[model samples]
Target: MKLKRCFDLVAGLIGLCLLAPLMLLIACWVKFDSPGPALFVQQRVGRHGVPFAIFKFRTMAHDGTAGNVPRMWPAPCITRAGHWLRRTKLDELPQLANVVLGQMSLVGPRPELARYVACYPPAVREKVLSVAPGITDWGSIKYRDEGSLLAAAADPERTYIEDILPVKLAFYQRYVDQRSFWMDLRIIASTVSTLWR
Candidate 1:
């Protein structure tokens, strides 16, 4: 995976450089819109079930546990600017730093909170945790409207645990079984197209 790591380093550095202005702008907007730090940090399950602080631009109000639950306001805790950032996935830009730091890959299973990871069956957990978690993966593209989907659920957490998470886990298992450098490139390309279109 030397080449994969190199690609991550190079692409992450380039992406960070290119997105600097936008990141800064978003940071400032988050600060102005809310009463908390612009960046949100949370413990996520990484490779081998190791926990790490994943970074993202804060898209909610200063409430400490706004994102801890499955469903919040459709636009509840979000600020005016936060809405745009979340919609465009710009809030995820800081994860390039995570990639550069080797905590994540460009394409792999999206890291989950420790609470959710605790629910993963041992074998499936090991399979998904065998690789570094990613910022984007097949599950991500397929569930790009996850917030909206959750908003429509009678019980968001239940629906996620029973329905959504299982499907995502299947995708993660498949990705782990079939991953390659070329596959990563294709996933990234597909993500870009999905985001832009």
Candidate 2:
């Protein structure tokens, strides 16, 4: 775990440094493309049941519900820039800051909103939250097109809660039980390849 933390810190710092220019360009584009701030922060359940602010590049239009529970895909609130950002997964770039702050990991179970975390069985919750949340994970890689999946659902949130969440929980448990430096590297590589494709 110590080594993992060290890797996260170093990788996070390096990522932020290397991507700073691109991130700044994206931020500016987001700002000019919409009426809202470039960055969005929302509360998320972290390791040990703690709550932390998760950061992202704002993809939705400015609205009172922006920080509320994530809405289903193909909703009207998304801005023009949002479509491209979400499609390219650039919306998640800001989470590198979360990684640098020790609020997240480079590879682990992705964090969830409090409401979703509350739905987890006690034992499952305990196991999943044992490690810090991450920007990328096996669950994330598998569901890279999650928005499209939700778009096809009759009740997106329900499908998420009843179906997707369970599968993600299982993946999370698997990650928790088998996590190591090499595993993290593989997950990261998988994520990058998934994105590249």
Candidate 3:
């Protein structure tokens, strides 16, 4: 895990350097395209269940609900710029800083909203939160089109809590139990491939 953290720190710095120009452009576009700041900061449950602010490029309209609402796939207020950013996953670029800062990992369970963390079944939550939350994981790969999947549901939030959340927890626990450098490499490769698809 020491090596994993070292890789995360190094890769995060490199990623930020390489993607800085793109992030800047997106930030500028978001500001002009929406009525809110370019960055969206939210409190998320981190390693050991500590709260930390995770940063992403603001991809929803200013008027959208600030709460950690479950159906985040599509909101009426999403600007045109935000839509493309989300589609390409460019919105997640800012989180590289979180990686550099040691608040996250490149390949671990995705961080959940604090409220969602609170709702986690006790044993599952404790096991899942044993490690740092990550930018991507097994569950994320499986649910790559999560927004569209939720949009197809009759009750998106209910579907998420009942089905999606549990599956994610299982995957998270799997990662927690089986995590290693090679596994992280595979997950990174998978994520890159998914982004290209």
User: Which pairs of residues collide in candidate 1?
Assistant: none
- TM values, all candidates: 0.95, 0.98, 0.95
lDDT tens per residue, model 2, 1-197? 89999999999999999999999999999999989899988999999999999999998888766787484554677889888888889999999999999999999999999999999999999999999999999999988888889988899999999999999999999999999999999999999998998
Please write out the lDDT profile of model 3 over residues 96-188, one tens digit for every residue: 999999999999999998777887989989999999999999898899888778878898877888989989998999999999999999999
Could you tell me the lDDT of residue 185 within candidate 1?
A: 90
Worst 10 residues of 2 by lDDT: 68-77
- lDDT by residue for model 1 (49-166), tens: 8898888988877777755643334457777777788778888999999999999999999999888888889999999999999999999999988887887889887888899999
How good is model 2 by TM-score? Answer: 0.98
All candidates in order of lDDT, best leading: 2, 1, 3
**How many backbone clashes are present in model 1?**
0
Q: By TM-score, how accurate is candidate 3?
A: 0.95
